[model samples]
Target: MLYTPAPLHIPDGFLSILVSVVCWAITIIVIGFAISKTNKALGEKQIPLMGVMAAFIFAAQMINFPVAGGTSGHLLGGALAAIVLGPWAGMLVMTAVIAVQALLFQDGGLLVMGANILNMGLVTAAIGYGLYRSVAGQSKTVKLTVVGIAAWLSVMAGALLTSLQLWLSGTSQLEIVIPAMLGVHALIGLGEALITVFALAFIIQTRPDLIGEGSESAKASRNWVFAGGIVSLLVVLLSPLASADPDGLERVAKDLGFLSVGQDAPYQVIPDYTVPFLGETALSTILAGVVGILVVGVIIVLIARGMKAKS
Candidate 1:
């Protein structure tokens, strides 16, 4: 299943406040570099796609699946976003997604923003992309399968990095967490692959032109961008049956009893899902999805506009 452990985000108390603050600092630094780097490539137009991808991926996360034991989690979309937009834009988009999830969903702590961004954003966008280009370089024939594999590998890589970070923090035994993380993530990676492949396949069919123009510039599609917006909106509107089975990371952490050492602290934001008109359960997820989508859409438009980037 998962190539990595249950690392959607380190639950509360796993990291210290100092560690959390450091993480945010790192995120800020990396983002500065990321923005500059993106501007260098396709100008500012690429910025909007970052926001668009974030909304799309955030919405996708709303739909959870059943793992082995009834625990559930949603797609990270790092690989999918990277593959679609290329690494540079992918990192930016992923950063946006993670940031919003931290702020709104409270899925990941605000304090650990840096570590979270690096784990999900840079790792998935950069590492996964490097592997894809290296292995499948321009092979349009097997692009779907290749991308499927890439998405799987990307999730695995992200999870592995997360596990490593946890290990570095000395939060838990890496020996226990690493295998648990990888095994569960391997399965979860399958879901990631399917989603990415299907989405890419659809894009290829309807608007192949939306892909890269040369290197990784202008890798935006009207349908996919719209589909991303629409699908995310759909996830917001629909009642996503998030699986109850502990996600790969959570499963491993539980199996190893990481929870024993890892404390579950109270959140600053109660009812993490406090969207208007949404209850405490699944409907909140829908409300979060919709609000997240619209917020991200506005952010994307603003970024693109600022960058003077094209759609």
Candidate 2:
């Protein structure tokens, strides 16, 4: 193994059903908030983009980075979305992906949806976005170096919070979990930073028209082609990184004795969600990411066409 995996892949038992329910309720409220970010809110044009963003994150999530000791983790994508879409909309997109993974793919735990959202959705979309904006506000385009650094920092921060959540839930000792989770992720965060910078750069170059404020917001759709092309490339490049070791969460749980506590989710993916090959973590993640991006791109196009139809 290369590292310990801490990505949210198991079902919940570390916490109670009540916790999951509360998180789900919170997810719903956040989604509602996200929907309100659109120019027309729930208009037909926005629905497609919303759905597409969900799929994009879903796909992006499949590619996990090898952290310490060969342990692997997935991409959270909140930062990317928040950079492109606003935080509220980013939350909506991220929640959709997590929800689908839990219900359809059976990836994340049902009980820890709140934990999942907090770690991936809220942390990345809200906190990460806040930092990015603070450094390079919505009006400014950060140098790729600056964006990469920010992305890495944002990912590191999110991983730290995930560990904290585990500690708070009594799943693992905070002391041990904190270092184990943060240490590995700090490295993985670089991968995130590189990918994020690349993606943002491509988008800006191809669709400079689609990125920013009023006129920019109106033109953002024009850059969909460039964005879609980037998606295709990411899908192809993503499958090679899955590590063989259990992730940070699993390692901490096993070491800290919380592994025995979380309800065992039936392992569905062969080699489950960590292998990088065609059968293991890598192949599935790449496939999932490509599928997700296409799904989102198609949805966005449909929405655009629909809005034009309505107009």
Candidate 3:
């Protein structure tokens, strides 16, 4: 039987309606600002770059690597996105990825999506870019070091925010939840850092112009776009090999006795990343992942192009 991956994000009923609403309000405001900022600065090449980044991030999130104590972790990709696309565009890319996960794959809950987007997308991008901008003219070694730190901190920030939301929702006490969430995520964050560092290192070595302020004037290259598409497809093809272990949040929730609080999605599209007709086979997962990347990539590209046109 195909392994059913545990929910990688906050599911429905994890937060009270009031907290969820508040998060929604905050997220909408931040996303509005991001759109305005990106509209003013988005370059022609960056439009397709946004799509490629979103596709890669979406594909990367599908494969969960094992961590200590039977828990697993996946790339959040905010740092990498921000480092490559700038924070505003990075936020947009992350928003597209997370939205697709919830709406298409039911990987995250609809009710808590605002918090998810805020924690995993907006905040991460901000932290990543904020820290990274300090080392703009540094060497590759220094840049990678900062990126790794930023990536790890981004994961910690997401965990901390999630813990707070859960506490505010009365799901757990602040003291207990904070430590539990932070402790496991600390290890998970290492994986995030390493993956981000390696990816950035590759980009820096091969296509240095694709990152930094220089990217604005970097001419669009079909070769880069095609290579990125192939990489995303390859990641999807490897989805079947992902570790069958509970993710950091799921592990923490189960340990804290709030695992039962997670509510099922009201509907299913390709629920749990498996094609319904295929009945939970590895091929089903690969196909579903392919569909997911394609949809998210197209959505982000369209949104970016629209913003570019407006600008």
lDDT of each: 0.61, 0.58, 0.68
Pitting candidate 2 against candidate 3, the one with the higher lDDT is: 3
Better of 1 and 2 by TM-score: 1
**lDDT tens digits, residues 129-224, model 2?**
544443333333545665666567656556665654555455666556666766677777777777787778898889977666332343443343
Return the lDDT, model 3, position 274.
Answer: 36
Candidates arranged by lDDT, highest first: 3, 1, 2
Q: At residue 167, what lDDT does model 2 achieve?
A: 53
Order by TM-score, highest first: 3, 1, 2
Candidate 1 lDDT tens digits, 1-311: 21223355876567755455656677688678767767887766656756777788777766666756777645778877777787667878888877776776677776577888877787666544644443333456566776777677667666666665565455756557666777778788888887777877888789988865356333333222332333223322321111222253354444443333333332532445233333354455556557976886787556445534431
In the range 113-221, model 3's lDDT, one tens digit per residue, is 9999988887777667755654556677987897888888778777777876786576876557766776777787898998899888998889977675544332332
Pick the TM-score winner: 3
Worst 10 residues of 2 by lDDT: 235-244
Assess every candidate by TM-score.
Answer: 0.61, 0.59, 0.65
lDDT of 3: 0.68
- When 2 and 3 are scored with TM-score, the better candidate is 3
